[model samples]
Target: MDRRLRSILKELIQAKKALTSKFIANINQVTPRTTQEDIKKLNQQLLSHGASIQSIKGRGYHLHIEDEQLFRHFLTTALYENKDQKQIPNTPDQRVRYIIQKLLLTMDYLKLEDLADEMYISKATIQNDMKLVREHLSNFYLDIRVKPNYGIRIIGEEMKIRFCMAEYLIQRGSDSNGNIYDGFIRLPKEQTDFIKQTIIAHLEKQHMTLSDIAIQNLFIHIAIAVLRIQNGHPVDNDANPKQEITHTKEYKVAEKIVGDTEQELGVIFPPTETSYVALHLLGTKILTTADIEKNQDIESLLDPAIYELVIAILDRIELEMHLNIRHDRDLMINLGLHLKPAMNRYKYGMNIRNPMLESIKKNYQLAFQAAVHAGVVIEKYTEVTIDENEIAYLALHIGAAMERQKLKQGPKRCLIVCASGMGTSQLIYYRLKTKFNGKMDIAGTTEYYRLSTYPLDDIDFIITTIPIHEDLGIPVVEVNAIISKDDLQHISSYIAGTPSNVIRDFLQEDYLFLNQSFHAKEDVLAFMVSEIESDDLKRARFLESIYEREKIAPTAFGNLVAIPHPLTPQSQQTFISIATLTEPIPWTTERTVQFVLLLSVKKNSVEDLQPLYEMISKLIEHPESLQKLMQMTDKASFMSMMETLERL
Candidate 1:
């Protein structure tokens, strides 16, 4: 019962088709031999649950379950409750079937003698395993056909065979000690030897050490990744969009080793199962920082944003360690420096000893600001936190900064201008409108027919998508018919030169309202509970208790709106009920609040605070609009009106 196997079977059942061994092998990175065995074991296990595996003469296997819903429930009950552990049902026959299916996936046709050797039992025991497999298949025409040449192959309907196989392997397997790791390793002697040789050969290049057990575990990781990827599961490592050649090559080498080992041991590491184990092993081994830098070409392969983050981190580490610390360079020293102090502080049971170290590493925001101030080459988030209307202004600043830094940004917003009266202006406006989506905002498409007309105010930059008869007293880039990228690039250079002192000053003003008025426990609770029905009295009492321990800080968030809530909570769920003042009540002894949001939650569930904060921020984005919403005569009307407004 491998986790990956269970997942793959579930995916197959969802897909409603019998997948080929070739597809499963490619995903699992197992050899054709191993896949066949895995399918056989899966079939044997499925029989106990009124399931069967059938193999169409030339086609691959498919699983047939008598009760799909019941099977899913049984699986959920068995696996989901304690998802991290690897425990199948209590039936001995089911357990035997599980082991046999896993072995089948690793070998083509495991002989009775080979099975006996691996299981530490006699020939009779090996035969009994097969007997249980057949008993499970008694309901169907499916039979384990034996050949002097091929050994054993399941024969029957393709759909049933594949379904049973997928169901068995989709679960995570349990070790003798009940540990779960992706999938289990059930390798024969030759295959095990070959895998070790392949691993040793590759590790020699890096001079790394890995035990035999580590090698098998490495294979299991790869096998799981391959299977998950094929079944459309999101893998943590696969998020990296880079093409890893050295890593991929190493996996190929592992596959070859497995094949060679299987041949030597007179076991089958069929072609279907080889690649998954190899790639998975290769990928997992290089997860360390040194390995990634050494093997991965991030500069050439990764996105600029990601690459900059990596460089920024490395630069910080290099500055501290006095070492270049390239991607591939050993990071053990730096990692140790960070981890040892934390471990020591915890071991000694003291919190105050590591103040300076924590200050440098803990404040990530300050660290980023430090990096920016130090002239470190990096990309900044283009859209800074500002008013919705101010986004266009911020965009101009971003364009300017990108130009100054010689960086590229897509889609330029252009302002078109002309004299107030003509057909020429209308013509340019129509063409530009048809050409670009409002990505290019025509601040004002003016007329050439009139000389002195409408005033063009607050135009950051302009692009005349058409030629002008007069200069129009502004920097203009003339285009023949359509606006070219080159024109936008030229405009970007000019826009970058505009003064940013005004925007910077606005940001520096500190618009955030800090500690304001604190409300009484009973008064606020009565206010909050007034909005809900009497049936929700328990909820009101809970909010009262939350307020008793933690005070509600009411901020006069300007524009006549006030959001009231305790910083921490002690409720089961986040109650986002609203309160409105009949009269404009002076909230902070200065500003008044007509609208308020009372956020209350249980103290232990501190994490729920963020969503309420964000929702409140979005609600108060437009103060004037909110003031209008709050003035509604009825509570139901106000609630109805508030529901229509979108949260950021």
Candidate 2:
């Protein structure tokens, strides 16, 4: 089968829902007609394979299996056919990924002609792909060295080579056992399963818990270590040992796991290998509240340095973002415990794969940004650069603290008022409770006639089935007898502290700068600072703080948007200043900025800034909106776009 057909079949096999023709075309980078033709060709070929593509009316296409055994056999044969005869990668992106995996798996130098022939591409295409391969390998500290008249080979530290191999060779989001036999550098499924079961059994016996992703990470580590050791590349024995890791109970558990793995796999592991396994254990352990409760002296279990490091991280986050999570004891303890093993991993140059890294970044943008700030402090102290995966794990802890803060603030107090009889009132009350259970607290249900007599001191809002005419300080939201999606949205907006008219309240015409000429980022900062009507010292300090924050990490979060702020509050009042450049300026190597949001928060202010952050994050995510706002020549048009984004 051709690559397009193979790609289509794979998508159908893996899809949980019917896939539209356009979706498949987008994935294959082809037109709908081409996808249809490929589907027809695939179905014709699948006739004898006991599988066929079934097209659903108004929906899309799905895979139908007539004979499971035959389909499985056919899939195995198609996937593992002769490498040279197999379909070539159809796209440059696919070829780049393929080249990386191929180079990481093969020890011998590969000629450009051979790779081009194998992938059924020209030598020029192969050379172009090599450029991307070299760039990708550089991230892992590996370089592609070309020997004249020979070929190109990857050269780097052995540890780094192995780390790159572990990253590229294994397929992500695979099964739970971390098996990679189907990919390049195949490992025996039985051995991988044995190692996974052994690790789980030992961890359970020691009363330790690890997330599935962490377990998968450890499984991959042990599997790769065993393979490398068998290939005569054991970890260096001369490296200094970590006394703290070797003394922990986790080390003993690692010892048992390595012993069983060695016996079962018929390989000898050095003491250093045991320590390496222990490092994974230390790095991946999840400290739950139950674990802390079971051991009253949980704080004593961690290294003193690790505890202090966590404190310093939270302090930096508080100082930089004003997140107010420094005093969250649970967050502090959990983050401290997590850092201990993480530091060990960093010391040994080990990378822990986080499958949820992208999801974490998307869903917990604020937390992830704060964690990035925390990561800068960690790197300053530890002298080791942290990867996005590790930063994502840190974001998990911080995101939990943010959630706990919301819970601690308690739910919004609202009184439900219904003018109808008791049955209607009861119905509305139960419906609201069911939908907004944890988010809202029902003060009590009362008829409109008795609403005046009822105490409203603690009420934050009044939910009424009829229009409320009484002038009460609290806002009244009117809804139908039965709640609706729109009603829920209104309640959610209130809960999020985003009033419909709130954006205009914060964004001022004076603060909005349109079509500015700025060549450098520093120039832009200076311009923004000069616009702020503050003392000269404060303006200078704010600019310096913005530079400091930029040093921690560039605030250019892609999509032609950048939100630059000071490391700490530099103003007595909070405000936002906006600027749009005539041309995009280089904010960072990977990002360009035309839209700039300079945020200034009040010192010691505890107001919720989530609504403003959400609005900015939305603009950052949607470049079309940014483009639309950029074209606007006045503040009125800009505020209109902001209103549209806020509704979204």
Candidate 3:
């Protein structure tokens, strides 16, 4: 099959929903007729392989497989048939990544028409891609330099080029184990393995060892250096080589490794390249508690400044979120060790890829938020904007600490709430205490008026008979004052953090805007922000905060959904203002969003918002859910749909 037909077939096979011809054409940059013809041709080829394309009347094209085993065998064969060849990217997303990597690797200028010819695409399609290309490059202060007849090449600081290369060339081609494979590089495995073994042997000889990931990173940089130097693109000698690093153990090891590799690969090692290798060693030098055994604690092992930065970050998180993990020694040790190298990355402008970023965001929402605040504090120390990838790495450490905190917490601690604990609230409190004595910790009873000022630092939730108008930085379960059987069961479910009862707390009808028309992300954000701050004054300059987070990283997490919010909490009460656009609006360079979920959380709220974020993450991963959500026209149906989201 041809590239275009194979592309369409792959889309249909991988699609969770039927693939629309228009959507297929938009990605391939072809006419609807061309897409239809391609699908028809693909179907003809798949018939003998036990699959066919079934086009529905009003919906779209779906793939029907007659024999799953046979079809899958064929797919596996086809998938690996071109393993040894360079793949011409089939879809827009693939093409953009390919273009970026190709340009980053190419030291010479590339003509648009030549690239178009190589990818089997029109010049117009590739040109349209360049707009996004330029936007991505601008983040790293890199841009395309086009000469009249010489064509275009990426032009920027050489260091920026290397940073971009580390991401696109090295990081992008990694496998599930975080191993850098030979996807874009032409170097053979024998040569790459030699480089890896050389570094490991030298490091081991020096009584220093790096993790598998760090070793893999070193191999990629060294491999790329060989290729680039062979192509006359050596690291510019003056690009900030530290003399201080030259005296360190990492430098001596790097120097010996370079000497051995020069003999094996038949290439001379430059002094600048040796320093570059040493710099990477310093940036990736992770020390665990096991590595620092002289003292039982690791505070003495880490740099004082980096250790202090970790304390500053923990102090800020405790002050804002009040999770009381500021004194977590494991968390402090890990974060301090991480920041020492992390600051090295920032000082030298290095980019490290976290393969588990999306999973970290989805599974650890609260921890991710805490890490974002930690990144804010890091900015004060490093004077450089922290990247989302870095924040996600920090989230892993914070999430582990949070789990440790959870294990120590026995029963859910909460308050018995009603009109007043002095009145019927006392009766409800006594009833709750008698009904569930050991399963829950009834700290005391609280009144609705005093809920805001009440110290809810370690409180798990509140059992209230009457409704609480605002979020009191704690979860509230609205049970009957008399405390019936069903109410007790509901409270138990909430104590378990099931959240089937608390989801409605976020889906207020006043904040729901359905089927709105928005042509751009700014319009969608402005509409949601205006509705959120209509009567509420706590979220002043809310839009700027949202943009501040976006400037760090775009929140459009694909699959037609976007969850945007301030980097830090802007409201005293946690709430959500949602908007469903009439059509998909361009939200980020790579994604268009039809569902906008503006999430705001109280700074010190102990409520588990994971279920809410899980529902949104489900929307991002499952296209059918987003389509159903975008088709809804009223708040009732929307809430009804959300009610069934936890099961997803």
Query: What C-alpha lDDT values do all the predictions have?
Result: 0.43, 0.79, 0.77
Model 2 scores worst on lDDT over the 10 consecutive residues at 79-88
Clashing pairs in 2: none
Please state every model's RMSD to the true fold in angstroms: 28.0, 9.2, 3.8
Predicted candidate 2 versus true structure: per-residue lDDT over 1-648, tens digit per residue: 767887788778866556767656655656789889889999998989998889889668878999999999998877545434534677666787778777766766888788888788998888887877887788788999898778888888767878887777776665765567434666787998899999999999988888777788788888888888888877777763646578888889999999999999999989888887887787556667676778766457567888778878888888767676888878888787678768878888888778787567556767877888888889999999887888888899999999898777778899999988899889888888888899889988999989889999888788999998766756787888877888888777777677545567567888889999998899999998898776623777889989977766567765567889886778866788999887777686435678899888777655567777777777755544556677679888888878888777
Candidate 3 lDDT, tens digit per residue, 146-219?
98888889998776776677777764545433344335755666677788778888887876757665676677
Report the lDDT of model 3 for residue 381.
84
Model 3 error, position 583 (Å): 3.3
**TM-score, cand. 2:** 0.66
Question: Which candidate do you rate higher for lDDT, 1 or 2?
Answer: 2
Q: Where is model 2 more than 4 Å wrong at Cα?
A: 1-93, 117-131, 240-249, 283-291, 294-302, 410-496, 499-607, 616-642
Q: Ten-residue segment with the worst summed lDDT in candidate 1? A: 505-514
* Residue 331, candidate 2: C-alpha displacement in angstroms: 0.9
Q: What TM-score, over all chains together, does every model reach? A: 0.22, 0.66, 0.87
Clashes of 1: 66
Residues 581-645, candidate 1, lDDT per residue (tens digit)? 44444453324455555545433331212223434554555443354454455544554445444
